[model samples]
Target: MDPLLPRPVQDLGHYRLPSWWTPGAPRWRQALWLLVGLPLLASELPGTPWRQWLLRLFGAQIGAGGRLKPRLRVKCPWRLVVGDHCWLGEAVWIDNLASVTLGDRVCISQGAYLCTGNHDVRSPGFELKVAPILIDNDAWIAAQAMLAPGTQVGAGAVVALAAVASGLIEPGVIVAGHPALVVGRR
Candidate 1:
């Protein structure tokens, strides 16, 4: 197996799409996403009410009453499962190189980054490791917060603005600063 491939591909003998489409699919999916999805989402940005329809049309598992703004980048919409009453703010990136599950009522603020892929240079060629991210219900990830690969944010947690979390953040807690350690909570 080629070490240049993703870990899943190397181990499973199959290839997933380039973080923007379904596995073994073509570039057309990505194009359609850009053309159709982007336009629809953009159109609904100013509370136009068309965003939900567009996201559902593009195969996002968005729950009822969930509002997603335009410019919300989703890498592989198929790998995303967002729950009910959630709000994904403008320019929020859900870079689901693997599966990313957001539980009910999760609020991913503007400029928040949820990334699930990394490079493993230990291999012959630098291989990619794409893990899943889980953000539990009622979580509030502030602006510019970064949730790194394989991270799990528990329910009702608050990741402060500009914070970077590469690991798990406990439930009902508040995390701030670089590398995102617990600051305080109730």
Candidate 2:
């Protein structure tokens, strides 16, 4: 094997996924969540109440009056926390490898992705890294936007369409563009 050549697929043993973090549910519960809970939650026919009930059953801490639209995908309900009157639009994917918390009246628009897991590119092994995401009260994540690991969307902040948000967003401001920047005040 040449030292300069990139290793074959079988030789790539450097990558390691963390075993300490559980999805906050037992194996059976996780299986049930994917098999039954997801389909029900993704259906419009079940309505908000039924969908909410399914999430609750899977251990999500969803507050009263929250509205999750059809096609919403939550990686782990047990690691999710949604506050009252929050709205999750169609095809919203919360890849909460760590905890994801949404405060009161937070709105995540269609096709938005909230990711709490990333790879450490600086490391040769490309280690998995996990961090929580927090969207404060009245924060709005616009359509197709992405909130990266460890980001905090401040109270009343607005992340504009298709933006990539990372790090902290100041309270009551509008941010846009890739690697989102403050565009204006709310």
Candidate 3:
């Protein structure tokens, strides 16, 4: 079901159930993401091809001059979108149970995890919860940072090392500390 479809068209398109759309993501893609992610996570050095292959195989909209380091682990590879000139550094785990969007020239440094899913502990079913994470162009996520669910990192923003990003990081600013707070201009 296309999200933007007109209501009448949506209703007429056939009542396609969610179960029909659900499937384990492509195996080849999973292998690719893991192939690149494991080495980057375990090793001290960088492997560009491995990372690139994974991103490409998983259908990410990665542009030329992009460098995804080996340590990045991306779940549901098909849901990730990375733009041109982006850099994903070591130990970057993107748990894209939902969607994770990265704009052009974005830099995600070492040990940064972009988590998009959580458990709905409040519900009796204890189901998996999800949200979208958006990082705009020219953003820099420094070493060991974590971006929580539904958070948006604006353009030209710099999130400092070891920061925990919970909400929105405004555009053109520098942020640091847990639940990252605006610090200065980027």
Candidate 4:
């Protein structure tokens, strides 16, 4: 093998998912949540109240008066929490393999992706790793932005369009670029 070449996974059987992680509800209940609950929650036909009702019914901790817009995908409703008057815009994907908490008045704009799971590249088995994500009060994640695992966006911060947030964002800052840097203060 060439020294510069990356090592491939030796044993796929050694891969193991985190023991702490579980589908919050029973298999049947989870199935129902995915099949029945998700569609209704993602529909534009149902207003905020109806969408919120569906989310709550599936065990998500959604506060009052938030708008969950059409076509948004939430992997695990039980692992999500959104505070009062938040807005999740169209086609936002919350891949919450771990917990994702959004504070009051947060706005996640169209096509933003919040991901809480990744793989350890150094591990021979390519082991899975997960961490929680937090978007504090009044933070705005603009269109097409991606928030990686363990990221914390501070209060009133803005992640600009198509940016990727892989670390902590200071309060009242505006960030832009692929790795997301502070461009200005809010």
Candidate 5:
């Protein structure tokens, strides 16, 4: 018996795709997103305003005074809504298979990932699941923080650096650590 032997079965190793799968956009829009939209936004050539404009052109609802840094990987601009005076730092990845809404004054710091999609482990075919992520007004998702699907950060809440947040973070609470426990209140 080899210690490095593989598991008898792996759901994802031999998974099959569902017949009804789609990229959530029409073929033309997906082509444009892949060809032009993602590349432009990921580049440092565009200034903050131009980047915002580009995202808007691809159907993102962006509000005033947004400071968007480069190297962002946004899965679908159509599923995103960013509010006034929001700041998104470099390397922020929005893997929004579902909707992601950020309220006014929200700040998503560097290297933060907001993921709105996951795969179900129980299913033999590895079924995909998606849910919306909501970050309310004045909330701060600190650097390197990872927000899981269906996570909601309430108004004035803070998800500290390197925190893995899921479920609801109550208003004005500061959460930290994996599975993000409430550490303080703002």
Candidate 6:
């Protein structure tokens, strides 16, 4: 939330976005990405390179030798940067209101959600809040896991399935559970 342009409303019905609020791109571009992604790029075919190409066209900086599987949903590819040899599994949702960076050899397993946006509950309007997420090299985000905003997953770390991770995760650690506690080391 922008403290500079905050709109404190008395009720939820009266809530409105701050004048400075923007989706970081034109509405048309956002629609176009959906049009291309849902129909073509997200297809359940054998064209990983084509999918990556389409993502690149939408301003995603994707490196080589990566596989983005079917049903992956990337909200605003312009805010995304992925490195080489990465694997984004099926149904992975990257709800990036801010930047999301994934280093080389990172694996985001199926149904994992990477959210760069949240709401400030303290605000009257439940104001939008955003922060960047950085997953370092060789990190493994397992299936159904959720990475919250501002999460910095360290290199070679493993976030176990269904774990919800936030803040900084140390390198080579294997984390599990709701808040992602340290279970082992890679």
TM-score of each model, paired residue for residue: 0.79, 0.90, 0.76, 0.91, 0.91, 0.89
- Clashing residue pair totals per candidate (backbone < 3 A): 0, 0, 3, 0, 0, 0
Model 6, range 1-186, lDDT digits (tens) per residue? 558755653357756776766777788888998776656765677668888988898889999898889988889888899999999999889999899999999999999999998877777776778899999999999999999999999999999999999999999999999989999999
lDDT of each: 0.80, 0.90, 0.77, 0.89, 0.91, 0.90
Q: Could you tell me which residue pairs clash in candidate 1? A: none
TM-score of 1: 0.79
Worst 10 residues of 5 by lDDT: 1-10
Candidate 2 lDDT over 133-165, as tens digits, reads 999999999999999999999999999999999
Candidate 5 wrong stretches, greater than 4 Å: 1-9, 13-22
Task: Name the lDDT of candidate 3.
Answer: 0.77
Indicate whether candidate 2 or candidate 5 has the larger lDDT.
Answer: 5
How far residue 169's Cα lies from its native spot in candidate 3, in Å, is 1.5
> lDDT by residue for model 3 over 29-148, one digit each (tens)?
567556764444445556676666655655766677877675467777678888888998877888887889999999999889899877555444445567899999999999999898
Better of 4 and 5 by lDDT: 5
C-alpha RMSD for every candidate = 6.3, 2.6, 9.9, 2.1, 2.4, 5.2
When 1 and 3 are scored with lDDT, the better candidate is 1
Worst 10 contiguous positions by lDDT, candidate 3: 8-17
What shift in Å separates residue 67 of candidate 4 from its native position after superposition?
A: 1.3
Q: Which stretches of candidate 3 lie over 4 Å from their true place?
A: 1-46
In model 6, the clashing pairs are none
Weakest ten-residue segment in model 1 by summed lDDT? 8-17
| Candidate 5 Cα lDDT to native | 0.91
lDDT score of model 6?
0.90
